[model samples]
Every structure is written in structure tokens, then in C-alpha cells.
Target: MNTVTPVRFDNVNVGDALPALDLPPLSRLTLALYCGASGDHNPIHVDLDFAKEAGMPDVFAHGMLSMAWLGRALTDWVPQSALRDFNVRFAAITHVGESIRCTGTVTEKFEHDGERLVRVSLATTNEAGVQKLLGEAVLSLP
Candidate 1:
């Protein structure tokens, strides 16, 4: 498991970039495991035949899986206790065999409820540079 390093609020800047996380290429086994673990047995994600029947060429990765990767990217930089808000919007389908990369940049910094906070804009893109997900996160820093 990756561990987060504590980030001090005063040390961060609005434009500082978070370390990028590159996930391995998605595979059929990964889709199946994620389906089982997440209880999202939607055939479009794990059954190629069902996907084809539904007009898709093949099964695709789950949207939440990509979101989880983005979350991992954030938590890998700062502890989960620092997170105050997180959300994502799926932008494109993530097909099997595609490698996903998660990235973020600090967009804002301020004090909320007497606590220092930072807002980050986040994204996940495929190896081809096509966006798969877009999101934002707010974290309380030490």
C-alpha cells in the first residue's frame, strides 16, 4: 500500500502539482474482480457478449474504478483524514487494456472554519491522453 506524506498548509501553493499516479492497463480479470468486490455486476463491464449485444464492441472498465484511482492519487499524496470533499464526473468510457493516469493541481487555498484548506482539480486520462474522468477535492492541511 502507498503511504501519504503529511503536507503542511503553508507549504502548498495554488499551482503546485500533485504527483501523478499511473495505473496498470485494465484487464478482463481486473474488471471481474472489481465487479465482485464492488457488487456492481453490470454486464456491460464484465461480460463481453452482453456488452456486444448492448452495442458496445467489448466490455469496459467501471466508472467508479476510475474514480477510485483518482481518490487513490489524492490519498497517496495526503492522508485520507485530510480530505474534506471529493467527487468526480465520468467523461469517457475506459476500455479494457487502457492504462489510466491520475493527476491533480492545487487550485485554491484558504481557511475554512479556522482550518487551513486546499482545493484541487483532478483528472484521469488514458495513455492516448483522452480524459476519462474529471473531479475536485478539498483537503484540510496541517
Candidate 2:
């Protein structure tokens, strides 16, 4: 396996692309694992049959899992950077087994109160380039 290293950015700037990340399909087991880790036990996430009966084709991936990739991309690129803020709104449901590509670009950078911060505009897309329009994230880095 190739070793992953953090990219050292001297003074954050605009137009920088965060490293790309690929996530596997969503599954009942995956949701269970996420629930164990995050302490979110919303039945809609793990109960597949219930989900199907509720009009969803299958158990959907956790919104956080999709957004977690975005956070990982940032930390992967800036290993030492501290994340000050992160947020994402679920725009669409991502079914299991879909390939999600996490990506981001630096939208702005500036110093606030003596702390350097970089604002990144983040998004995720599927192999076919469908984002599910799932969500957008802004990460503040120091």
C-alpha cells in the first residue's frame, strides 16, 4: 500500500484542490458500524426492510459517512491543520454500493484574529458524476 502523507501548505490559498477520496457502497453492516462509532441509532439507517417498505429502495448510507470523506480529504492534505468548523446538509439519499468521490477546493483564505484559516468548498460525486447533490461543506483550518 502506498503510504499517505499530509501535504504541507504554506499560507493557504484559493484554487487548491483537496485530495480525492473514494468510498465503497452503503450497506446494513456499514450503517451498523457507523452507528456504533457515532452513537446515532436512527432506524431509517439500518433497517433495510423497513426502509424499503417506507418507499426507499434500500438502506441508505449515513449522511455523515458521505461528509466524513470530505473531512478526511482535508486532514489528509493538511495533516497538522486543526479543523475549526465543518458542516453538511443531506441533499439526496445515496444507496448502497455507489461509488462516492469526495473532493474540495479552497475558496478563500485569510487570517482571522491572528489565526490563519482556509475556507474550502467541498462536494462529493458518484462514478457517473452524480453528486446525489448530497451536500456542501465548509471547513475552517488552522
Candidate 3:
């Protein structure tokens, strides 16, 4: 059963936290598949030898892959139509076999131009609590 806890605009408040999204531990196959799907084809993400040649200890997950995870978490919480703007910056490299958790906190809620709006601060962190992605998103509510 797919259970979705609906987020209603009227009940939202500043500082409200969104339900978190947990992803399975990342893997080499996952990174390779993501590379194929995203057309990134960056050797640094999928080729261990290339990554080592680049001075990295191992191949790393693409920043956008983690960003996509964060976006999926947000849209899963509320309807995608409610999303007005979303942006993120990569904070640290996410490597294979790391667990990622996507989380968000409502930062502001207000009415603008007769539209209900909420701003959320978002983050993706690994098992060690190292932040891999820092981001913000704006939602327009009905």
C-alpha cells in the first residue's frame, strides 16, 4: 500500500518539518545507471580507475543525483504543482555505499499576491551526518 500523508496549506506553519525520505545505500550499479539515465557520462562518477587518476580515492555519485533525490522527497511530500522554485548546492561528495537522508524544514509561510507560500530549507546527509546537499525550495499552496 502506498500511503501518502497529505500536506495541507492551511495547516502549515513556519518551522514545520517535512517528513524525511530515506534512500537505499548507494552502489556502483546505481551510479552507473544514473550516469546512463542522466547522460552525464562523466568518468569520474562511473569509472573507478578514472576517479583514482583524478586523485579521488574512488568513484563518487554525481551531485545532481543527490539533488534529484532531494527533489523527489519534496515532491513526494506535496504535489509537484505546489513547487514554485527549488535550488541546491553540493556540499560534499557522495560516494558509493553511503546512505542518504533527505530532510526539510519550513522556513517561512505567508500570503503573497493572494497566494499562500511556503519556503523550505532542505538537506541531504549521509550516515555520518555529513551534509551532501544544501538547498531551498518555494511552494505555492492552494
TM-score between candidate 1 and the true structure: 0.95
What are the per-residue Cα lDDT tens digits for candidate 1 across 1-142? 4444468898999999999999998999999999999999999998888999999999999999999899889988888889999989999999889999999999999998999999999999999899989999999998
**What does candidate 2's lDDT look like per residue over 1-142, in tens digits?**
2226433336556897766887776556778898789888877788877887888877887788777777777667665336766766677777777888888888777677666677777778878887654333444443
The deviation in Å at residue 90 for candidate 2 is 1.4
C-alpha lDDT score of every prediction, in listed order: 0.92, 0.70, 0.90
Cα displacement (angstroms), candidate 3, residue 87, comes to 0.7
Name the 10 consecutive residues with the lowest summed lDDT in model 1: 1-10
For each candidate, give its TM-score against the true structure.
Answer: 0.95, 0.80, 0.93
Instruction: Using lDDT as the measure, name the better of candidate 1 and candidate 2.
Output: 1
What CA RMSD would candidate 3 show?
1.7
> Which candidate number maximizes TM-score?
1
Q: lDDT score, residue 107, model 2?
A: 78
Could you give me the TM-score of model 2 versus the true structure?
0.80
Candidate achieving the largest lDDT: 1
Off by over 4 Å in 3: 1-5
